[model samples]
Target: MTKMTFRKLLAATALTGITATAVVAEEVDYGKFDGYTLRVKLIGGAQYEPLYARIAEWEAMTGATVDVLSRKNHFELDREIKQDIAAGTLDWCVGSNHTSFAPQYGSIYIDLNGVIADATLAEFQSLALENSTVDGRLVQLPRHSDISNLYYIKSLFEDADNQAKFEAEYGYALTPPETWDQVKDQAMFFADAPTFYGTQFVGKDEAITGRFYELLIANGGALFDDDWNPTFNSAAGVEAVNFFKDLYEAQAVPAGSLNYLWDDTGLGFASGTVALNLDWAGWASFFNDPENSKIAGDIGLVRAPKGSAGIRTGWSGSHSFSITETCDNQAAAASFVTFLTSHESQMVEATAGLLPTRAAVWDDAKAQFTADGNNFLVEVFETYAVSMSEDAFTPPLITPWIEVSNEIWPQLQAAILGEKTPQEALDEAADAARIVMEDAGYL
Candidate 1:
């Protein structure tokens, strides 16, 4: 029989990591549009801003100017879009969109089927293009895939004394975990509270909702039945919720973890204080950079762990660009959208460890990594490739996904904070979500 070590687990079912290397790709022809200004709303952060910097390149090539109306995180941008929908103010030409959030926007964004060339659309991964489509309309052009995997301080698992002690206490070798239960055990074992943590999670908003939803699926639980009755209060659901509750109660994570978003958990891991982090590929470049990460050279990567049902937690989405349906200059908007997702543009993002949506970019990026003697990036690309093909799945493509999430998160906080049992909180959240579904005519 083959020995199943932690290092072996990181590949196959074990999982992925990354770093940056610039590759200049040939530019595509985005028609000239002199004397035109394009307006956009973008998702802004360190990992994402590098791609937006290339907007200047797009402008120079096309002779058009870009006016970025707002540059904020997705959660904030989501609220702005929601308000725009409520107030009838979706006047911008193009905006950032996500597969998980696109259904809620109705038809404010134009269909890209005829807008973008079929030849160009053919270059993107079919699964990516499929996720960007809502109600049979290709509402957005995918930028990159968003899938999380495990990242940890490598030296921690490699320490002989620590490994021996952990093996004695847990009756297993101290290695990268193959399952979520192992994750909990290792986390608590490594934790030394207030000074450091075993692990940390994104604590609130649709962020936490996605985390819970994925864990629920991992535990063989469904959020709703075939008829759409909310079923997140089942035994499997309770088990999933307890995963977070136990971590919080044991102080395995930071005291402020319930309020952490991506930045907090990401920076925590980079600071070398946290033992484990499950995060997106976009941050891989930053995490492995010595200038930015204290544990840069000592990092280990693995696929996200499996739950009791043997399913890995794979809550996935894509960051994308979309043109508004009401734009006065549809041709210009289309040109701009096409330019941003072109081969060269994806190459720029690929350097930042952002997973490319363009199928060719993946091959080219991995080739560049191998040529550069960057085995870390090569391993990351290989591990993440398996995840993208087999494990990745989006939340239910429905108009009320965010609305339902609003009801679920607060109750989840209640459960984690010890105010309610997992069942009680999920049941109440389900009651609220049922009303939302009925109001939306899903029931």
Candidate 2:
């Protein structure tokens, strides 16, 4: 299907509401704010927009109007927020936030500790709430949490002819890859290039840098030492960089991968050309929908694979809502955020395949899927829950994380595209990361 039609279908599928009784049994008492306008700046995207449609419910319940002042992608929104800080234009009461992006805003957002009820806070997963904290302050209410797992074409492993050829060449039985080494071997084995690639990766900006960071962790290396000194130029780091370089050198991944991002990788997998893709739970419904994917019935999933150090690569973050400290209506803002993250709202998102931050929603959504006979999504939730609970880790919650990412990814592209050896590239990246750490007063 065309991207436009696919998005429309997703919007329709996502906006289907559950019963009001299923949402909240005890009504929220948001006093009265008849003439008040609760201004918000939310992330606008196909997956995120449907949830905004429910803002009307919040307005109606509390006699307040929600004025969405700005709607942009995260990067654009981040820039706008920076400008807002610099110009003293944070007039909007609430804004979209991420765990990685929250620390940079300093004291602009309110500490949501006592604003949201203890019961509500207790309902969310502890790990997600912990990630949302900055300087011991709970600054954002997590909307959803994300970490990736591998998706591949099941037929590639099950095909007798392909299996026989793979076994003959590699001297091992072909199955879903359990390690990055096996992933590489399988990718190379399945590759045909141009017409079909073995795999693809997010290749620029924080996307590539985040991918590298997770791999570095999985290989027993880290971005910084206890002193906050850059330390990712180690042997483990070299192994991590070479993984991407080797794939590019063999033409196992696409030539245009350096220009690709998450959407590119998702659509590539859905097109049935890529042999393997590591992506978030958000794409599970899309990847298995016959209307949107050529590989709909043939797809297979496995938990994210391990690296040389035997740790699973689970770089995670949460999309969240934060109430600004400057807001005149903290109660109304809290009400809106609470409603958006309610069990019903989360169920709406979960039905469309977005992972939930609320623990109860996990079982409720899975049971709903099972009852509906959506075995694909059933497996998707079960697999992702383990990763979200035990395997997931976030980058150090520091302001310069994005700045460090900016310096690292361009050099990463240069290395992957053959302009530098993996060691040389990582050394350069380490030096640049040191400069960032120093500038942030962490040195």
Candidate 3:
């Protein structure tokens, strides 16, 4: 196995929560744009909305105004941004960007390589900055990173009767799974129809595509060969696809899983019916909140399991902010993005369980969680901080990515639902993806 990769600073501070502040306070010129009403578009959702409350602070600091043109979820926002790009009406100055979605925007956003100060960029994890770059230009400043780990019900694993039954039946101890196959066995074992389920997954759209991509890599498959030819129809790919198909066919996941997305899966786990959920850290607080979660005090987490190749299934990205290339006030826009992703702003977001892109905040936030005796969150940070740095990787950074994804995900859903065999489905999707790449001049 490969040596575990992680940010040295984070690994050194693990569990102990020894506070060592890495972000140096620096005075930044929040350039004066007193009368400027900077129009912006953003991704809207519950976990993301809390950070907007801090926007007023930036407005006050800069003596400028923000005119939010729209606040829709990412899919809607993506369509609008594409329309804006095509219509040459990028009137908005700033917008939300993600590592997976940014490549599709091409040159619509300004390159921040020369705009953001080097010292400020230095504070962020280098991998995040690298992921934000497209064609060697810094297109976005990362706000928070995303990666999944397994979340399970502690009580289920601790029941003596259940343990004995699982051991006798599966020839192994009943515990949090260490591999995808084991997850399947355990999920099938714990399933109890409409009352409870073993686990759930985001079943449709790019969400499922991303899930499949990571598992494909885990099972020793690649989406594309070095020459950009679609190669996800390999045996490894079949294994990955079958994992999901098996769970759905066995009724281990929810019945409506085919239509579910992040919210559905997160809420399903919190409802206490789902025993295992592979999810991002952003939902940690919500999953543990007494008022919101039925399993509030009974959650357990483990690093995402390995596939046949001994690699964890880690499909990762970041939510970020970017300035438009056509902005009327680039300086003001730059200052605003910097302020939004600043150390203090990140601290606020991280405290509520979002994984920080800033390396230093990992230590600072874990320290605070430790001081509060929140061992759960402390362990969460430790596990995710390593995953973010070591295992996290973005989709193929190319302009036709989203277009390619639109073709692949539906085919994936069809295969999972038994509309086609995994091989047949992947072969059809690869043929379509090949045309996409060829039309984009990649092949």
Candidate 4:
């Protein structure tokens, strides 16, 4: 089936959780917002656009109108929101948010704990809700969780010639990698550059910084010491940075990888030229549908590989919604966000492979995939579910996280591009991070 068809079919499947266990089907109410125009700024992308399709339903039910002031990718949307904050023009009622980015917004967003009903909050996964809280404020309502696992072309590992060749050279049978070291070895081995490469990463911005952070944590490193002093320049940090540097040096990843982000990495893997991709569940169907992926039906997956410390790399967060503190219509804004993250709405998103923030949707999504005979998606959820629960963690949830990340990524890029040694790059980044932490009163 085509990728588009798969999505449409999934949405129509009527899997469980039309009303989650904690949600009152008819007892609780979505307050009337008649004639109230709830202005919002949203994060836009193919995977996220479908949920917006239900906006009319909410409008009809509440007799209100939604004014989407802007729709841009998360990075651009974040920049725009910051601009609004600086200009003191937070006229919009709702905006898109992320766990990694919410802290920086501070008091600009109101605490949702009081605005949203406690019963509604109870419907979400406790861990996700906990992560959404920053400095004791429930600033955002999680739309969907984000966590990654490894995806590879299964056919390559199944080839008799390839398996024998790999076994002869590495003294082990060729299979999906179970550790970061094996990933490097296999990626380097499979790379036939200009035609095919072994793996790729989102190499710039907080994208790279977050990647480095998770790998650092997997190697038993922390970004800060007990007193909140910068400590990522430790030996573990050097090791983490070297992994990317070595890949770039060996041409195991794309030549233009340093410029890539999530979209670039997702599309690169779908093009069938990359062997292993660490990606979120949102792309599971896209990567397996012949209409969108050249390697469709040839995909394999596993939990993200472990670092030297035996911990898996599971950097995670959520795409979410928030209400502005300056809003004149907080009640309307609250209702709108609640409806957007409702069980039925989340079910629509989950059908398209986005992980749910509500705990019940996990089992429902898996059961639906099983009923549809989609073993790949079933495995994707199973693997990601475990990784998210056991290995997933966020970057430091502090006001200066983005500022600190900005200082670190450039140095990380320089190291990966061979302009600086890994130790030198991390040392510089650590110095810059220390300044940011100190400025934020963390040091």
TM-score of 4: 0.93
**What is the per-residue lDDT of model 3 for residues 54-147, given as tens digits with 9 covering 90 to 100?**
8898898888999989999888999999899889889989999899999989888989987988767767777788789899889999999999
Using lDDT, rank the candidates from best to worst.
Answer: 3, 2, 4, 1
Per residue, candidate 1 scores C-alpha lDDT tens digits across 405-429 of: 9999999999999999899999999
lDDT of 4 at 79: 89
User: How high is each candidate's TM-score?
Assistant: 0.91, 0.93, 0.94, 0.93
Question: How well does model 4 score by local distance difference test?
Answer: 0.87
- lDDT score, residue 166, model 1? 100
Which pairs clash inside model 3? none
> Which residue pairs collide in model 1, if any?
9-14, 10-14, 10-15, 14-303, 15-303
TM-score of model 3 (CA atoms)? 0.94
- lDDT for model 1, please: 0.86
**lDDT (C-alpha, whole model) for all candidates:** 0.86, 0.88, 0.88, 0.87
Better of 3 and 4 by TM-score: 3
Give lDDT tens digits, candidate 4, residues 18-131: 345634633557788888888999999888999999999889989999999999988898889889988989999999999989999989999999799887776777667767
Tell me the spans in candidate 4 whose CA falls farther than 4 Å from its real position: 1-27
Instruction: Report clashes for each candidate as comma-separated counts.
Output: 5, 0, 0, 0
